[model samples]
Target: MLIKWISAAALAGALLASPATAVDLTVWAQTDLSPSASLGPVAEAFTDLYARFQRENPDITLKYEILPGGTEALPNLLTAASVGNLPDVAILDSFWVARLAETGHLQPLNDLWPAAERADVLPAAIDTMTFDGKIYAAMFSNAWRGVFYRTDQAKSLGIDAPPASWDEFLAFADKAKAAGMKPIMIPGADTEVTTLHLISTFWGFGGDLVDATGKPIFFEGANRTALEKTYALYRDLVQRGLLGTEVSTMDEKALRPFFYTGEAAAIANTSSGLQQMYSDAPTLKGNIGVFALPLPDGGRAAPILGGQTWGIFADDDAHKQAAWKLVSFMLQPANLTAIDAAKGYLPVNQAVWAQPFYAGDPLMQQFKGIFDGAKIVKTRPPVPIYPTISSALSQQVAGILNGTLTPTVAVDQARDIVMAEYTRQSAR
Candidate 1:
């Protein structure tokens, strides 16, 4: 047995607790919010939240085990869910919810996480967590992704100001080059990050990533033009010798150190990247800022929202109740604020916006406005095949940046690759 169920009433002196007999829940997670995982204020914030949870529920003992994410995690999850051999709780990525929920192993969270509680967060949280009318998970946080730049380094980079549109951005490149820094670095290798970071640009130019049937349409008429314009941005920089060949190998993580050291003028990143910079490169602290990735003339912003959610796998009522208690406590506005603020996640709970962190953080203040004015906000499509699509698009982007393929050829190849996957899935 992975868990040793102990009732809250039994742990306490009470003969009968309101929950009757809530068991201690076990958690399986791949999260990075552990105190040991970060330094400075981030560690302090996470440590305080965990300590507060312990103080609030002195009798409830919680246990956690690390789990892998991505390809390796899926089969293990499927097998466990099938046999009813699962932990009381799991921190499942939003990306995996569709496939896991389809297996009928995840318990619907509505019974424990009431509608009142659901209403406490952004609509996207509920929208993404629900699959076919069932809410299978409670979202803890999401990434508000955009362009990150160093306010302190702006003078050194020769950038007069943060660019608000593509014309300004193209003009800013010259200023950055004169200062011997890369104008902007985009990830081409980490396909999902690459896709998410650039999809806004593609969508802004009137591109449709997928058709109504969930089939990819990157090479189709208007989308083709939109994609060409998107990739051309990267191609133009390469042609100008502003971006080195190393950019083709870079992902979001690889883009950071350059920014941290003031070697790059700007880069694409999520909210968490701000805290990470504070932790990893303390000197960049107050100098960091973010802006929406600007679009071309007549184009609008398309922001992608991605999240992580808590999934209950405990079958017995006792363990399930305990899991909810643990999950709910972690999600409490004050506690979650510590986690979200320190870890750099955008808050899922609407109440957290009123917290001091949002008010004090300059980057968050700027991002909130960008989020408000965003023309399109959506999660990656909920279909199970979306990952495959994301990966294929990412590959084409790498080719475009590396000069291995023209924008036209890259999209054509991506269309064929993705359509092949749709065919395979259909036949199955």
Candidate 2:
């Protein structure tokens, strides 16, 4: 017995003396900032950021796989997950967090992440990556949608400030129209943009898309009222000719020439796009201004939050920790600030906001204020069914806008479709 114990102890000591094996981590990242949306130098900027990470961590070998945006990345990841071929770390769209979370493929970060790290994240922004009481991912980049208007146009039309409420928005629209300017441009041509805009309007009208358990509840009394109010707003925009004929065909990018050149008085888009616009047309910088999207009476304003997040996939403790280290490195204030500045995304960490770069910039200051006031919303619910639901809403709303369906019929049909999906999901 004594001889056997001695031999075991010797083997344990030898094992402990062996050098730790190096870890090789593969990271999947999107080249474009958003799905179908590209800001200046996003891919190059991320490459530089990854090079920096490599410099700092000499031991870990990094392999990067750049994925295409818009309907490509998620499907790729899903396929990989099915075969257990997922990368160690991946940057996921904020909306995909919930869907992936439900798959059980993602590692819950609540155990891996520290509470102190969450201290300064805007609560609603944090909600984007959270599901089932655990944070499944960390926000890497951030964006919010707000009303962008030509300040000079508004002032020349005798408007002292941007609209504060839906009534005020309509009144301002009327004035802008009288002044020979298109009031606002809604990007209904792009399904995601259309979804985000309508979601904002619905939320502002005190509507919610899903209940806490991720069930569709938009047809409930108050929620249905909010939906109708949003529908009415869109109908009014069409009737008043505020949206105009081109809205049916033009995506957000197509509206840029109009908005930047002062053909449109106001437009709503992700806050990051503001920086891109300013960069592309320097002359329009001082002429532009932004504000949170206005709400209807008895409602609250919350610009829908959009951005990318990094999550871990490997299950082994060592690999998970190694992946987390890379994620944590990317989240460092300076590194994250540079990435956000390059991509035109707002920083998710509040500490990054304190940096002089954001504080000194007037546009970023406005974003800071928006975050401070909690005027943010995560438009998509954290459910597997959201992508389908969003696509359906986009199509149904387009129908409503084109006069093919009334709001009541559209809402009822949408509800039935979602409930059917919910039942399908339950059966699975």
User: Whose TM-score is greatest here?
Assistant: 1
Off by over 4 Å in 1: 1-22, 35-51, 69-71, 156-160
* Candidate 1 structure, TM-score to reference: 0.89
TM-score of each prediction: 0.89, 0.87
Q: Scored by CA lDDT, what does every candidate get? A: 0.76, 0.77
Model 2 lDDT at residue 306 = 64
In model 1, what is the error at residue 195, expressed in angstroms?
1.9
lDDT of 2 by residue, 155-261 (tens): 98888777777788888889888888898888776387777778877887878888887788888899999887887777768877777756766666777888877
Q: What global local distance difference test value does model 2 have? A: 0.77
Give lDDT tens digits, candidate 1, residues 10-86.
55645445333434657777636455453466567756766776667755656766666545677778888888777
Prediction 1 global C-alpha lDDT? 0.76
Residue 196 shift from truth in candidate 1, angstroms: 1.9
